[model samples]
Target: MQRSSYRYLVVDVFADRPGAGNPLGVVLDAADWDSMRMQAFAAWTNLSETVYFLPPTTLDASYRIRIFTPRQELPFAGHPSVGAAWVSLETGLVSDTDRLVQECAAGRLPVRVVGTGPQRMITLRAPRARPVGIEPPPQALRAVLASLPTAGLQAALWNNGPSWWLMELEDDAAVRGLAPDLAAIAALTQATAAVGLAVFGRTPAGADHDLAVRAFCPADNIPEDPVTGSVNACIAAALDAADALPGHDGRYIASQGRELGRDGRVALQVDADGEVWIGGHVQGIIDGRATW
Candidate 1:
């Protein structure tokens, strides 16, 4: 009944401090694990996502990772990418301390690190997000948005590795106060081939962050994702396209997961070249071994 024990870590991503951000589980010695085993462990963790690292197949990459949700494998995800990079750097697995390349199913991505120790921030250059057409599911979308005032703002569907439907409400209060009909949202996401629906709104001035954000993903079995990076990245792209950034600047801070009692802040930026990057603070909370 003995099985191999692999080194694993649980890290907080995007939190200003411990126990405040999205939690991610990572396995470092999974080079030989098959997809079935990876999925099983990912399901057991039941995190928004879990990642397994393997030796890089490409010469230019620092490492390769396979990402999984409880129900399926993901080509790319924001938190997992950041978490994996942080662990790699912390464990001395990274080739370049300043910036490293992460190879995933989505592709090779750049991971940039700033500062050091607990103050370190890791950022991932997200795949460019673009609004795509979906089969009209206005009925379900309307049902989910019922009783909410959505004027002058439009719902956008974007695919940036992890697809999502993004909506910008009137203000942060509306975004936080929303209680969407989950069933309707589930139907719409299923029909559109998206992971879920996310909403964001402008926070009042003097707030710590520029926006409030929340995500619903019944398809992925996540009712409300604490702090979502992929969705936030796409939202930044959408905002940039519309030239609607709060300060007409290229970047802003977002606050999420407060309703769930966890404080997650995501820094979003659209660079001059139009690439959206998601950055946040990451800390290793638990470093241990896992038997699978």
Candidate 2:
């Protein structure tokens, strides 16, 4: 029996509170595994996404990571990046406690550790996101979005490694009340080479969050992503481009996953230069060694 050892951890990212967030699988000491092994393990775990830690090949990067969905590898992902960095810092894979740079296929990105202990927060600056494609939206979504207000934002594709079709509905109620057609969404995503579709709407005044968000990705087998960071960042970019972000300050809290029985909040910041950063609290789930 050949037992290849790797330290694995499952940490919930984007949690508003402990135990209420999207879970990410982190595999450490995975330098020995090739892409096939990594993909196989990702498929076996069946999480939205899984990540592997490897030695940094770049000069200033604290470490390198590879992201994989159950079906294929991705250049970058929001929750996985933040969750992996948390595990890295906690497991001493990284020397610095305050900040570290990550090297991935999307290039080097910065991660920051905020506060301390269980209440600590981790934030990552995503690869600069931008709206992509000027074509019309998929016909599959016409029935789904019929009569829904655009909320002053254009419906378009946003790209940040993965592409997502983002739209803003009338209000948070419209977002929370949404029931997506999985088959239609899957077909649309597959046809457009996109990961999924994300919809956001303004929450009522005085709410803890400024907006409500939802993501659907049946093409990747995720009927509804619990809390998604990448798509959140993309939506922020789109909102900023349209000048339709709530309060116009470029900093707001977004609530997601409530419809899925999970509560998670993502903090989005669009800097003066329009660079988008997403941050949230993480809760650790599983910590143990794995044999492959």
Candidate 3:
């Protein structure tokens, strides 16, 4: 017996450079790939996440896609969807003439491709976010502000369906260039009732994005996410709905990964229709095969 060879492409999402954006493995035309094999491959890839593509079952459908992290499968993912959709459009799996609709565990998602050349962009609509309420475990707050001076740090909880611990910082400096205790977060996540942690605050004048953020999910196998669209989407929604966005109303940009040096920027737009649009540029890192 022999193991079937699986062909995949690696992409760097939310990055203009090779080693910058979050890396993702996109398996082109992975109809033959099973869930078990995909899970194994995802863990082996060891990237934040890997996306597998499948042909639509119905003629009216566009494409069916699945997202997997190292330890678990996700209902939705930001970078992988954008990267995979870009690959799909460029590879002719999806036509440029028609907009692409990707079916995932989260539900059907639409990705619109735009522009030509380096500035070309892809915008993804995160699953409609509802106010998850607000209150967090006490220790989770301590874990996030562990590095801070505690002068202006505050913690709260938001529980819609996914429990998120929202932490507010004094300024941009407190938000960026700091590290969270991953093990503490893992422990707090178990000890608490929340699903993850979201740290959000204003950005300094120098950063590229309007807001800076970092997310941690102990159970999700991601301690500190390089950049998470959905998490940011949820945060943006919460802020916008609560009338917390600075001078502007209902629109913002989020910066992530500054501490890890990956530094990623995500464009966010909150519409009156109650939808959040996250747009970013993705680059193809290794277009060839990985022997391992």
Which window of ten consecutive residues has the lowest lDDT sum in model 3? 149-158
Stretches > 4 Å off in candidate 2 = 1-3, 134-138, 141-144, 147-150
- Top candidate when judged by lDDT against the true structure: 1
* Pairs with backbone N, CA or C atoms under 3 Å apart (clashes), candidate 2: none
Clashes of 2: 0
Per-model lDDT: 0.87, 0.86, 0.72
TM for candidate 3 is 0.85
The order by descending TM-score is 1, 2, 3
Candidate 3: tens digits of C-alpha lDDT, residues 1-292:
3235556788777776666677888887678778898899889877888998887765655788888888777778778877877778766777774366778777778777787433558888888776543344356557656765332334555543345666766666767656667777777666666557777778666556677788888666777778777777777667766767642556677878767789678888888887877888877767665443
| Residue 78 displacement in candidate 1 (angstroms) | 0.6
True-vs-predicted CA distance for residue 268, candidate 2, Å: 0.6
Task: Give the TM-scores of the predictions, in the order they appear.
Answer: 0.95, 0.95, 0.85
Better of 1 and 2 by lDDT: 1
lDDT of 1 by residue, 1-292 (tens): 3358989899999987988999999999687899999999998998999999999999999989999988889888898998898888888877538888999998999988897766889999998888898656467777766756554358878989988988888899888888777888898898778899988899888887898889988888888888889998998888888888764458899989998899999998889999998999987799999988
**Which model is ahead, 2 or 3, in terms of TM-score?**
2
Clashes of each: 0, 0, 5
